[model samples]
Target chain A: MTDDVAVLGAGLHPWGKWGRGFVAYGTAAARAALLDAGVGWREVGSIVGAATVRGGYPGHVAGATFAKALGWQGARAASVYAACASGAQAINTARAQILAGIADVVLVVGADSAPRGFFRPADGDRPDDPDWLRFRVLGATNPTYFGLYARRRMAVHGDTADDFARVKVKNAAVGALNPNARYRKRLTVEEVEASAVVADPLRLLDICATSDGGAAVVLSSMEFARRHGAAAPVRIRSVSTVTPRFPNTVLDLPDIATDSAVAVEPSGETFRSSIARTAYEEAGIGPDDLSLAEVYDLSTALELQWYEDLGLCAEGEAAKLLRAGATTLGGRIPVNVSGGLSSFGEAVPAQAIAQVCELTWQLRGDAGDRQVAGARVGITANQGLFGHGSAVIAVR
Target chain B: MPRVLTPVVSGWFAGDGDDFHLVGTRCSACGSVFFPREDVFCRNPGCEGGDLTETPLSGTGRIWSYTDTRYQPPSPYVTSPELPWRPYALVAVELEAERIVVLGQAVPGVTVADLAVGMEMRVVPGVLHEDAHTTWTTWHWRPTGVAG
Candidate 1:
C-alpha cells in the first residue's frame, strides 16, 4: 500500500433541496474545512474539485470555479468528473498531489445543487447517446434500473420486499442521529411498505432522492499533519478507482445492452466485487479488517448487494447478515453509520466525499449517536455511470 | 390496423418463421462478437484492428432474469398521453453462442407470472408505437410455443 495521507479536516453543508448555486455550497464547505483544519485559506497549496455538469461552463473547470469562490491564492488547481464517483476521484487527485510533493496541504471539495425529480437526460433526442436512448426506448428511469436489480435479487436470492425495507429502516435510524442527514426521522418497514411505488418492487422510500449538498476534505502528508500539531489523524489507506473488464453483462444503468460475451469469457467477479477486491489487495486488508462501511445505497436492495460485493459476507448471504444484526451498530461490522444515500439522498458529487467524512468521524470516535465504538478502519464504496469503480479505505 | 416490422437497431435480425436469426458482428481478431454492431474500432483492448463480419445469432436462449415495468417510462418512448399506462414484462435472455445476455420486452400477452428462470425464448420483431405516418419498431422476446 502507498503511504497514507492524514485527513486534517472534514466538512459538509447539510444535504437538502436548497435553491443555491453549487459554488455557494462548495465555498461554504471549503471554508468550514479550513476552520476545522485550523488553517487559513492561503495555507492550502492545492484545490481539487469534483465537478457537476449542472453548473454549465464553470463546472467543467470545477477546481478553478471553487478556487475563485474561495478567492484564488494562486494555488494549483485540478478538477475531475466521474459521474457519481467524482468526490472519490477528487480525493484521489488531491492524494496524488500530496504524495508527489506538489502540495503540503490540499483541499478537496464536491458540491452540487441537484435538479429536482427523476434525473432526466439533457434535453432533445440523440439516439447515439446511451443515456437518452435508454429513456426514449425503455422509459428506464434511474429507479427502473434499481427496480430491475431488486427484482432480480428477489428471483435469484429469494430476497423479499420486507428485506429491502429493513435496509431503509436500519439506515434511517442512523440518519436520525446524523445532524447533516437530509431525513432525520427514523423509518419502519411498515412505512416502507406503505410508501408509493416509484419502480416496481422498489418503493419511493427504497430509492435515494435528488438533493443539494456539499462536502469537503482537508488532506495533508503525514509529516505536514504532525508539524501542523495534529498528533494523530485519520489516514486514507487506499483509494480504488478501477474500470470494468470487458464482457460486463449486468446491464448497468443508462445502457441499452450488455457487452457481448461471445468473444471473451466473462470475468469471475462482477464489476462491483472487483472494485472492493482491488481496494482490499491494495490496502493489504481483508473484509474482516473493516470496522465499518459506507456504501452507495441508491436503493435499499443495492446496499445488501454491496455487503456481498465488499466481501463482508458470502454471496446471497447479505440478507442473512442483516437479519443477524452483523451489519448494524455493535455488530461485527457496522455499515452506513452516516445514514447512507438512503437517508442523505444523492447530491452525486457530494455523497462519496460525505461517506469519507463519516468514516473520518467514526474513526476519530467523534460520531455522536451512531458511533461504531472503537472504530479503527472504514471503507466507502460507490459506483459511477459508464464503468467507474470508487472505494476508499481509511484507518485511524 | 397495421403491424409494423422493424428492429430497434437495424440489421439485428431478418427473415421470418424457422429461418429467423439474430445478427451480430464478429471481430476477426480475438474473435469477439458484438451485438448492436460495432462499426468503428474493436472494443477488445488486447486485439489490433480486425474486420467485423455479420453473423446470425442463435435462435434460442434461456431467460437469465425477468421483471415488469409497472410505471410508464418517460419520453423518447412514445405513448399517448390520454391512454392509461400498460405494464410490460422485460426479460434478459442469455444466448449460449454469443455467451451474452440481451434484454427485450416480452411479446404481447406475456407477463412476469408466465416466465421462469432458464425458460427458452426467441427474438421476434414488435411494434413499439405508431402515429398516422411512422411506426416505431423494436424487438420482443416470445416463448417458442406461443403463437402470435
Candidate 2:
C-alpha cells in the first residue's frame, strides 16, 4: 500500500443555483477548510485547484486564482482539469506532493457555477470535436446517455423504473439531512414517475441537475498531522486515477462510436470497475471492508450501476441489493450518505473533492443526521469524460 | 432559393440509399478500426504503428440500446425556434464484424416505443437540418426490413 496522507480538514459551500462566480464559492470553501484544519493560509506549502471550463481565463488557471484570493504567501501551485474527475485529480496532486516530501500541507479546491438546462459544448461549429458533433449530428444531450444506460439495465438486468426511483427516494431522504445538498425534500416513486422525462426511462428527478457550488480539503503528511495535534485524522489510503483500456466496448459520453474490438478482445473489466479495483488494490482493502461508499450518482440508475462496478454486489444484483435496503442507512452498507449528486446536483470540478469531504465527515462521525455508525473505511468512485477514471479510499 | 445538400461533416460517410455506410479507418498493422475516421494514426496500444485506411463499416447491426430526447437540445444543434420541438429516438447499434457500437438518430417518427434492444438496425442517410440555401445531411438508423 502507498504511504497515507492525512485528511486534516474538509469543507463545502452549500450547493444550489446561487448565481455567483466559481471563485466566490471556491474561496469560501477553502477558507472553511482552513478553519477546520486549524491551519493558516501562509502555513500551506502548496495549493492545487481543479479547473472549470466555463469560468473563462481565471477558471483555467484556478490554482493561481484561488491562491491570489486566499492571499498568496509564495505557496507552490498547480491546476488540473479532468471534467467530472477534476476534483479527484486535484486531491491526488496534493497527496503526491505530501508523499514526495515536496510539501507538508497542501490545500486542494474545486468549484463550479454551472450553466442552466443541458450542459452544452462551447459555442461554434467545430465538426472535428466529438462533444460538438454529438449535439450537431444527433442532438444527443447528456441525459440521453443516462437514459440509454437505464434502459440497458432494464433489458439486461430486469431493472424496472420503480427500482430506479427507489434510489432517488433513498438518497433524497438522506440528502434532507445534509445542509450542503441542493435538493433536500424526500421524493416518492410517484413523484419521480410524474416528473417530466428528460430522456426516456429517466425522468427529471432521476437525473442530477447542474448547480453552482464548491468543496475543498486540506491534506498533509502523517507526521505533519500528528505534529498539528490531529492525532487520529482520517487518512486517504489510495487515489486511483486510471484510463480505459484499448478497445473500450461501452459507448461513453462525447463519443459517437466505441473502439472496435477487431484487433483486441474486450478486457471484460469495464473502466468504472477497474477504477474501484485499482483503488482497492492500492489501499489493501476490498469492497467487503468498506463501511460506506460515495459514488457519482449522475442518475439514480447510474448509482445502481456503480454498486455493481464497485463490487458492492455481483453483476445484475445492484437492483436486488437496493431492494433489500442494503444500500440505505442502517443497512449492511450505506451508499451516498451525503445525498450524492442527486442531492447536490453537480458542481463539475468540485464533485470529486466533495465526495472525499463526505467520506471524511462520515469517517470522523461528523455527519450528524446522515452519519454511518462506526464508519471506519469509505470509498468514492467517479468517471470523467474522455476516459478519466477516478476512485479514492479513505480510512479512519 | 434552391437548397444544396451537404454532409454535416465530410468524409464520415458516403454513397446513397442501401449502398450507404459509415466510413471508418482500419490499421494495416493491427487491423483496429476507428470511427469518425482517424486519419493520423492507429489507436491500438499494442501495435507499434500502421497505415490507417478508409473503410466502409457494415451496413447493418443490432441495437445495443435506445433512448429519446424529450427536451430540446441547446445551441449548435440546429432547430427551428419558430416551430414546436419534436423529440427523436437514438439507437446504439453493435456491428457484428467490426465489433464496434455506433450511435445514430433513428429515422424520423420512430420513437422509443418502437425500439427494443437487439433489434436489427441499418444505417441510412437523412437530413440533420435545413437552411434557406442548403439541407445538412447526416446518418440515421432504421430497423432492417422496415420501409422508410
Candidate 3:
C-alpha cells in the first residue's frame, strides 16, 4: 500500500436548492471541516477546489475563488475538473501531496449550483466538440444513455423495472437519516413506480437530480495526525484514478460509438470493474473486507452494475443480492449508507469527498442512525464523464 | 420539391432508391474502421501508419442495443421549439466485418416498442433539421422490412 494519509476531519452543508452561489456552500463546508479538524486557516499548507462548470469563468478556477473567499491565507492552491469525479480527484491530489512530503495538512473542497432540467452543453455551433456533436446529430442526452444501459441490463440479466425501483427505495431510506441529503423522505417502491417516466424503464425518481451542495475534508500526513493528538484517525489506504482500456466496448458518455473489437480483443474486466479492482489491488484488500461501499448511483440500474463491478456479488447476481436484502442496512453489507446520489442528488465536485466523509463517520462509530456496525473497511466507486475513473479505499 | 443537398460529410452515401451506404475510413495499417470518416489520422495505436482510405460501411447490421429519447434534447440539437416534442429511437449497430459499433437515429415512424436487441437494420438518409436556405441532412437506421 502507498503511504497512508489520515482523514483529519470531514464536513458537509445540507444538500438542497437554496438558490445560492456554490461559493457560500463551499465556504460553509470548509469552515466546518476546519473546525472539525481544529486547524486554523493559516495552518493549512494548501487548498484544492473541485471546479464547477456552471459557475462561468470563475468556476473554472475554483481554487483561488474558494481560497479568496476564505480570506486569502496565501496557501498554495490548485483546481481540478473531472466531471462527476471532480471531488474525488481533488482528494486524491491532496493525498499525493501529503505522501510526497509536500504538505503536512491540506484541505479539499467541491461544490456546485446546478441548473434545472436536462443538462445541456455550453452554447455553440462547433461540430468538433463531441458533446455538442452528439446533441446536434443524434439528440442523445445523458438520461438517454442511462436508459440505454438500463435497458441493456434488462435484456442481458433479466432485471426488471422493480429491481430499479428497489434501489431507489433502499437509498432513500438511508437518505432519510442523512441530514445533509437533499431528498430525505423515505421512498417506497410505489412512489418510484408513480413517478413520471423520464426514460423508458427508468423514471424521474430513478435518476439523480441536480442540486446545490458542498462537501469538504481536511487531510494530513500520518505523523501530523499523531502530532495533532489524533493517532487513531481513519486512514486512506488507496486512491485509484484509472482510465478505460482500448477497445472499450461499453458505450460511455459523449461517445456515439464503441471502439471496434475487430482490431484488439477487449479486456476481461470492464472499465467500472477496473476502477474498483485497481483500488483493491492498491490497498491489498478484496470486496469481502468491505463493511460498506458508496457507489455512483447516477441512475438506479447503474448502482446495481456497480454491485457487480465492485465484486460485492458475482455477475448477474446483483438483483438476487438486492432481493435477498444483503445490500440493505442490517444486511450482509450496506451499500450507500450515506444516501448516495439517488437521494443526495448530485453536487458533482463534492460527491467523491462526501463518500469519504460517510466512511469516516461509519469507521469512527459516529454514523448515528445509518451506521454500519463494526465497520472496518469501506470503498467508494465512481466513474466520470469522458473516460475518467475514481475509487477510494479507507480503513480504521 | 427542391434538389437534395448533400450533408456536411460526403461519399458516405450516394444515389437514390437502393443505393445508400454510410461512408467511413478503413485503416490500411491495422485494418481498423471508423464512422463519420476519420480522415486526419488512424485511431489505432498499434498501427504501423499506412495509407488510410475511405470505405463504405456495410448497409446492414444487427442491433447491439437500442434506446429512445423520451425528452426534448437540449441544443446544439436544432428542434422546433414551436412544435410538440416527439421521441425517436437510437440504435447501436454491430457491423460484423467492420468490427465496430456505430450509433444512429432509427428511421422515422420507428419507436422503442418496435425494436429488439438483435433486429436487422439498414442505413438510410433522413432530415436532421432545415433552414430557409438549406435542409440539414443526416443518416438514420431503418429496419429492413420498412420500405422508404
Interface Cα RMSD, each model? 2.0, 0.7, 1.5
lDDT of each: 0.87, 0.95, 0.88
Candidate 2 lDDT score relative to the true structure: 0.95
- Where is model 2 chain B poorest over a 10-residue stretch in terms of lDDT? B139-148
Docking class of 3: medium
Give the Cα-based TM-score of candidate 2 against the true structure: 0.99
Give the better candidate number (1 or 3) by lDDT. 3
Please, what is the TM-score per model?
A: 0.95, 0.99, 0.97
Q: Total clashing residue pairs per candidate?
A: 0, 0, 1
Clashing pairs in 3: B12-B23
Off by over 4 Å in 2: none
- The sequence of per-residue lDDT tens digits that candidate 1 reaches over residues B1-148 is 5645555556767767667677778898878888766777789877897998888878789887777777676676777999998888877788887888777788878987788778899887777787775677777889876876
lDDT of 1 at B14: 73
Better of 1 and 2 by DockQ: 2
* Candidate with more favorable, higher lDDT: 2 or 3: 2
Mind sharing the TM-score for model 3? 0.97
Real contacts recovered, all predictions? 0.53, 0.89, 0.66
